[model samples]
Target chain A: MRATTIHAPRDIRLSTVPDPTITAPTDAIVRVLAACICGSDLWPYRGENPIDEGVTIGHEAVGVVEEVGAEVTSFRAGDFVIVPFDHCDNTCPHCLAGVQSACDHLGFTTSGQAELTRVNQAEGSLVKTEGTIDDALLPSLLALSDVMATGWHAAVAAGVRQGGTAVVVGDGAVGLCGVIAAHELGAERIIAMSRHADRQALAREFGATEVVAERDDAGVAAVLELTGGVGADAVLECVGTDQAIRTAFEVARPGSTVGFVGVPHGVELPVRHMFRRNIGLAGGMAPVRRYLPDLLDRVLDGRIDPGRVFDLTLPLDEVAEGYRAMDERRAIKVLLRP
Target chain B: MRATTIHAPRDIRLSTVPDPTITAPTDAIVRVLAACICGSDLWPYRGENPIDEGVTIGHEAVGVVEEVGAEVTSFRAGDFVIVPFDHCDNTCPHCLAGVQSACDHLGFTTSGQAELTRVNQAEGSLVKTEGTIDDALLPSLLALSDVMATGWHAAVAAGVRQGGTAVVVGDGAVGLCGVIAAHELGAERIIAMSRHADRQALAREFGATEVVAERDDAGVAAVLELTGGVGADAVLECVGTDQAIRTAFEVARPGSTVGFVGVPHGVELPVRHMFRRNIGLAGGMAPVRRYLPDLLDRVLDGRIDPGRVFDLTLPLDEVAEGYRAMDERRAIKVLLRP
Candidate 1:
C-alpha cells in the first residue's frame, strides 16, 4: 500500500507501506477513495507543529470497507463509509451523550491518506452510505467525516437557532462549512469574518449574509456595527488563534455562547470579560461521529454543497503538491483521489 | 434616614443620612422591611475588596414602596417589592434576552440596608408580591433579590434538566439556593460540596441528595465517584475562588455546562482543559430581575423556602453585628430588619 508520509517540515512523499489488516475484533480495513489536506496538517508541514519522521498523515477520508473483524457488525466488505476523524465505541457514556470525541475507548483514524487504513471500533464508528457511491458526492461525503461535522458542532454548541444571527470567525474550510451549518440551522443572518477576497466570496456562496474584512478591535467594531451594536446571537470561533478567540467573544451578544472548534494555541481565555458580559464558551475537538449520519443525509439530499470547499484536486501520488498548495494558500482545500 | 455605612475594613455602622428621594422619573424609594448580609458583602468587610469611607453598603432587600417617581408605572406607594441587587430597564437587548444584569441602562440598588433606599429602573426591577406580604415570607422574598435568584441563575445557566445529575460547588447561601434550584429544575440527583456541617444540613434540606465534604482533588474524585466516573450532568459554581471554579469544571460531564455566578477574583479559566473535555462555562452576575417573577411565585406558593438560608436575624441598628456574623461564618446568612 502507498501512503503519504511526513519526514520533516514541507517534506511529504507518497511511499510504500505495509497493507492494513483488521488487527482487533472490532477493527476493519478501509481502502481510501478520497482524502484531503487539512489546515491542521499544515502545522507540521509548515514546521509549526513538531513531527515524528516517516509517520503516515491525514485523518479525514471516505472509503469502501475492505475487510472486517469478527465483532464488526455495522459494516461489511465493499460497503461505502465515511471515516470520522476519531473512532469511538459509540455506546460509552460520553458517546451516548453525543460527545463521541471524548469516548472512553477513543482512537484516532490511522493512515487515512493511503490506499488502505485500519479503523478501530468499526461497528460504532463507521457510517455506511446508502446505495452505490456517486463520484460527484465523494468530496461532500468525505467532509462529513470531519470538517463539515466540526462546523456543525460549532453551530450546535453556539446555540444558533432559526431567525438568529451567527458570526463565523475564520474563513478556513471548517469555517466555510460553519456558514453552511448556520444556514441549515436557520440563521437569518450569517456574518463571515475574513480578509481574503476569494475566501470571502466562498463564504458568501455558503450563505454568509455579511462579511467583515477587518481584524482585531476593528473587526469587533465592524461586527458590532453590523449587528446594531448588540453583537451576534451565536458566534463560531473556527480559528484557535488568540485574536480570533478574543474577537469571537467580543462580538457575541450577552447570553450568547461562543462555540470554538479550533485547536487552541497560546490563547488565554478572557474569564473576567466573559463573566462581566455574561458570555459563554462551548465546543472543543468536534464529536464528528455524532454528526456524521445527519450530515451525510444533508449531503445526499443536495441541501448543502460543502464539497465546493475543495478548490483543488490531485492524484494520491501527488500528495506533496497538495500540501504545498494548501500551505501556500493557493487552495482552500485539496481533495486527493486514490 | 439611617443607612449602614462602611468606614473601612470591619467598620459597619448605622449612620444618619439624607432621606432618599426620587431623583429620576425611573426611580422609586422603598422603606426597608428586610435586608440580608451577603457573602459578597463580606468581601469589603474583610478588606478583600477596597472600600471608600462612609459609603452606604448593601444591595439586597425586600421593602414597601414608599414613593415612586412620576414615570414609574409598575410600582406605586404601599406596594411590597423585592429589590434585586441590580436595576435594569428590562427592555434593552440584553434584558430582553433574559440577561438583565447586562441591561443597556443597568444600575445597582443604592442604600438597600438603610431605612429608605432608592431603586432605579423601578418599574422594570421591582417584582410586586400578591396581596399583603406576610412577615414570614419577608425573608424568602428578600432571598429572591440576590442569593436565591443567583442560585437559580446558576442552575438555569448550567442547563439543569429533568432526571439529570447536578453538582453544586460552594455551600454558601447561594449554593444552598442552588440545591433548591436544581431540585426545582427536576434534577433527580443533587450533590452539594461543602465542609460545614450546618451548611450540609441546609443543603440536604434544600434537596441535595448527596454531600461531598472534600476539597480540591478529593472533591473532584468524590463527585466523579458519585456519578460512576462520568461527572455531573450540570455543575453550579457558587464560590468565585480558583479552587471552586477548578472543581466545578473537573466534575462536569463531557458536554455539560458549568453555570458560574461567583464574582471571580484572581481566577484563571482552564481553557485547555475545558476545550479537551468539551465542557462549557456559562453564567455570570445573576439577572435576578429576569428570574424574579418565577422565583417570587415559588416563594409565594411555598414550593421553595430559599429564606431558610438566613439562620440569624438582627435589628437594623445591629448591622455591624450582622456583617461580623457573616464575616466569621458564624451564620449562613444574616437577615436585618428595620
Candidate 2:
C-alpha cells in the first residue's frame, strides 16, 4: 500500500507503506475510495504542530469496509461508508450528550493517509450510506467525512438562526462550506472574508450575501458596516490565527456568539472584552460524527455540493503534488482518488 | 444631601453634597434607604481602578422615589423601588432581548455613595415594590438591586439545568448568592470555592452541596474529581481575576457552559484549550432590571434571604467605616443606612 507520510516540515511524500489489518475486536479495515487534505493537516505540514517521523497525514475519507473484527456488528464486508475523523464508542456519556468529539473511548486512526486504513470503534465512527454512491457524488459525499460536518458544526456552535447574520472569517474549504451550512440553517445574510477571487466567487455561489476583501481590523470593520454597525449575529472563526480570532471578537455584536472551528494557533481571547460585551464563545474540534448524517442527506438531495471546494483532484499516487498545490495556496482543497 | 465621595484611593469621606434633581426628562430622584459596598467597588478603592475625583461610588440601592421628571411614568413620588446599578431604557431592542445592561440608552447614575441619587431612564430602571416594604424586608429587596440579580444572571447565562452539577468560583457575596440562584434553578449539586468559614457557611446555607478550599488548578482538579472526572455541568465565575476565569474553564465539562458575572479586573482566556474542550462562555454585567421583579417576589415571599450577605450594618454617617470594613475583608458586604 502507498500512503502520504510526513518526515519533516514541508516534507510530505507518497511512499510505499505496509497495509493495515483489523487489530481490535471493534476495528474494521477500510479501503479508502477518496481522501482530501484538511485545514488541520496544514498544521503539521507547515511545522506549526509537532509531528512524529513518518506519520500518516489525512483524516477525511469515504471507503468500503473490506474486513471487520469480531465485535463489529453494524458494518459488514463491502459496505460503503463515510468515516468521521475521530473514532468514538457511541455509548459514552459524552457521545450520548451529542458531543462525540469528547467520547470517552475516543481515538484518532489515520494510517499515513493510505489506500487501506483501520477504523477503530467502527460501529460508532462509520455511517453507512443507503447504497453504493454514484461516482459523481463520491467527492461530495467524501466531504461529509470531515470538512462538511466541521462547517456545519461551526454554524451550529455559533447558534446560527433563520434570519440571522453570519460572518465567516476564512476562505478555506471549511470556511466556504460554513457559508453553505449557515445558509442552510437560514441565515439571512452570509458574509465571507476572502482575498482570492476564486474562493470569493465560490463563497457567493454557496450563499454568501457579501464578501469583505480586507483582513484583520479592516475585515471586521467591513462586517460591522454591513451589519449597520451592530456587527454579525454570529461570527464563525474558521481560521485559527490570532488575527482571525481577534476579528471574530471585533465583528460580533453584544450578546452575539463567535463559533470558532479552526484549530486555534496562538489565539488568546481578551477576556475582559468578551465578558463586557456578553459575547458567547464555543467551538473546538468539530464533532463531525454528530453532524455527518444531516450533511450527507443534504449532499444526497443535491441541496449542496461541498466538493466544489476541491479545486484540484489527482490520483492517490500524486498525493505529493496535491500537498504541494495546497501548501503553496494554489488550491483551497485537494481531492485524491485511490 | 449627604453622600459618600471617594476623592482618591482610601480617601472616602461622608459630607454634605447638593441634592440630586431630575437631570433628564426620564430621570427620577430617589432618597436612598440603604446602599451597600460592592465587591466591584473594592477594585477602585484598592487602586486597581482609578478613582475619579469626587466620584459617587455606590451602585446598589433601594430607595423611595422622591421626585419624577415629566416623562417618568412608571415611577413617582413615594414609590419604594429597587434601582438597578445600570440605568437602561427597557424599550430598546437589546433590552427587549433581556440584555438591559447593554441597553441602547444605557446610563450610570451614582455620585460616589449618595443619600439622594438620580436614576436615569427611571421608567425602566426602577422596579417598584407591590407595596411599602417593612424594615425587615428592606435588605433583601436591596439585594435584588445588584448582587442577587448578578448571581441569577450567572446561573441563567451558564444554562444550569435541573439536576446539573454547578461549580462556582469566588466566595464574595455575589458568588454566595450564585449558590442560591443555582439551587433555585434546580441544580442538584453546587460546589462553592471558599476558604473563609463565614462564606463557606453562607454558601452551605444557600445550598452549596460541597465547599472546596482551593484555588486554580487544585480547585479544578477537586471539582473534576467530585464529578467523577467529567467536570461540572455548569460553572459560575463570580470573580473576575485571571485565576478564577481559568478555573471556570478547567472545571467545565465539554458541552457545558461557564457563566461569568464578575466585573473583570484582569483575565485572559486560553483560546486553544477552550477551542479543544468545546466549553461555552457567556456572561457580563447583570441585567438587574430584567430579574428584579421575579427576584423581588422571591424575597417578598420569604423564599430566599439574599441580604444575609451583609454581615455588618452602619449609619449613613459611618459610610467611611462601611468602606473600611469591606476593604479590610472583615465583612463580605456592608450595609449603610440613611
Candidate 3:
C-alpha cells in the first residue's frame, strides 16, 4: 500500500508501506476514496511543529469499509463512510456530553491519505451514507469527515443565533465552511475576513453578506462598521495565529463569544480585556464526530456545498505537489483521489 | 453629609463632604440605609489596586430615595431602592441585551457609604422595593446591590443546569453567595473551596454539599476525585487571583464553562490547556440591574437569604473599623448602618 509520509520540513512523499490490518476487536480496514490536506498539517510540513521522521500523515477521509473485526457492529464490508479525524468510543462520559474530542478512548486516524487505512473504534467514529452515493458528491461527503464539522462546532460554540451577525476570522477551507454553518444556523449577516480576491468571492458564495479585506486594526474597524459600531454578535476564529486571535476578540461585541478551532500557535489570550468587556472564549479541537450526523444530512440534502473549497485536486501519487500547493497558498484546499 | 473616604492605604476616614444633589435629569439622591464592605474594596485598602487619595469608596447600598431630578420617572422621594454598583441607561444596546455593565453610558456609583448618595440613571439603575416593611431585610436587599447579583451572574454564565454539579472557588461573601446561586439554579451538588473554618461553615449553610479546604494542586485533585475524575459540570470563579482562576479551570470538565466575576488581577489564561480540553471561560462584572427584579423578588419572598454573609454590623462612623475587620479576615463581610 502507498501512503503519505513526512520526513522533515517541506519533505512530503508518497511512500510504499505495508498494508494496514485490523489489529483490535473494534477496528476496521478501510479503502479510502478521497482525502484532503488540512491547514493544521502545514505545521510540521513548514517545520513549525517538531516532526518524528517517517510518520504517517493526513487524518481526514471518506472511504469504503473492506473488513471489520467481530466487535464492529455498526459497519460492514463495502459500506461507504466518513471517518472523523479524532476517533472515539461514543459511549464515554465526555462523548455522551457531546464533547467527543475529549473522549476517554480518543485516538487519531493517521495514514488516512493511503490506499488502505485501519480505523479503531469503528462503530463509534464512522458515519455511513444510506446507499451508493454519487461520485460528484465525494468532496462534500469527505468534508463532513473534518473541516465542515469543525466549522459547525465553531458556530455552535460561538452561540451564533438566528438573525444575529457572525464574523469569520480566516479564509481557509474551515473558515469558508463556517460561513455556511452560520448561514444554516440562521445568521442574518455573515462577514468573512479575507485579503485574497478569490477567497473573498468564495466566501460571498458561501453566504457571507460582506467581506473585509483589511488586516489587524483595520479589519476590526471594518467589522465594527459593518455591525453598526457594536462589533459582531458571534465570532468564529478559524486561524490560530496571535494576530488572528487578537483581531477576533477586538471585533466581538460586549457579550459575544469567540469560538476558536485552529490549533493555537503562540497565542496569548487577553484575559483582562475579555474580563472587562464581558467577552468569552470557547471552542477548541472540534468534536467532529459529534457533528457528523447533522452535517452529513445537510450535505446529502444539498443545503450546503462545502466541496467548493477544493480549488485543486490531485492523484494520490502527486501527494507532494498537493502539499506544496497548499503550503505555498496556491490552493485553498487540495483533494486527493486514492 | 459624612462619607467614607480613603486618604491612603489603610487610612479610611469618615469625613464631612458636600451633600449629594440631583445633578443630571436622570439622577436621584438616596439616603443610605445600609452599605457593605466588599472583597474588591479591600484591594484598594490593602494597597493592591492603586488608590486615588480622598476618593469616596463604597459602591453597594440599599437606601431611601430622598430626591429625584425632573426627568426621573421611575423613582421618587421616600421610595426604598437597591442601587446597583454600576449605573446605566436601560435603553442602550448592551443593556437591552441584558449586559447593563457594558452599557454605552455606563457609570459607577460612588459615595454609597455616605449619608446621602447620588445615583445616575435613576430610572434604570434603581429597583424600588414595593412598600418596604422591616429593617431586618435591609442587609439582604443590600446584598442584591452587588455580591449576590455577582454570584448569580457567575452561575448563569457557567450554564448551570438541573441535575448538574457545580464547583465554586473562593470563600468570601461572593463565593458564599455563589453556593446559594448554584442551589437556586437547581444544581444537584455544590462544592465549595475554602480554607477558613468560619467561611467553610457559612458555605455549608449556604448550600455547599461538600467542602474542599485544599489549595493549588491538592484542591484540583480533590475536586477531580469528587466528580469521579471528570471534574464539575460548571465552575464559578469568585476570586480574581491567578491561583483561583487556575483552580477554577482545573476543576471544570470538558465542554463546561468557568464563569468568572472577580475583578481579575495578574491572571494569565491557560489558553493551550483550555483549547485542548474544550473548556470555556465566560462572565465578568455582573449586570446587577438586569437581575434586580428576580433577585429582589426572591429576597422579598424569603426564598433566599444572601445577607447572612454580613456577620458584622457597625455604625456609619465606624466605617474605618469595618474596613479593618474585613482586611484582617475577621469578618466575611461588614454591614455599615447610617
Per-candidate DockQ vs. reference = 0.77, 0.70, 0.79
Provide backbone clash counts, one per model. Answer: 0, 6, 0
- Model 1, runs deviating above 4 Å: none
> Mind listing the fnat for each candidate?
0.72, 0.65, 0.70
lDDT of 3 at A12: 92
- lDDT (10s digit) by residue, model 3, range B119-189: 88988889987775498999899999999999999999999999899999999999999999999999999
Per-model interface RMSD values are 0.6, 1.2, 0.7
Q: Which ten residues in a row have the lowest lDDT in candidate 3 chain A?
A: A112-121
Candidate that beats the other on DockQ, 2 or 3, i.e. the better one = 3
Deviating ranges (above 4 Å) for candidate 2 = none
Interface RMSD of predicted model 2: 1.2
Which residue pairs show backbone clashes in model 3? none
Superposition error at B138 for model 1 (Å)? 1.1
Model 3 alpha-carbon miss at residue B136, Å:
0.2
Q: Where does candidate 1 clash, by residue pair?
A: none
Query: Rank by DockQ, descending?
Result: 3, 1, 2
Candidate rank order under TM-score: 3, 1, 2
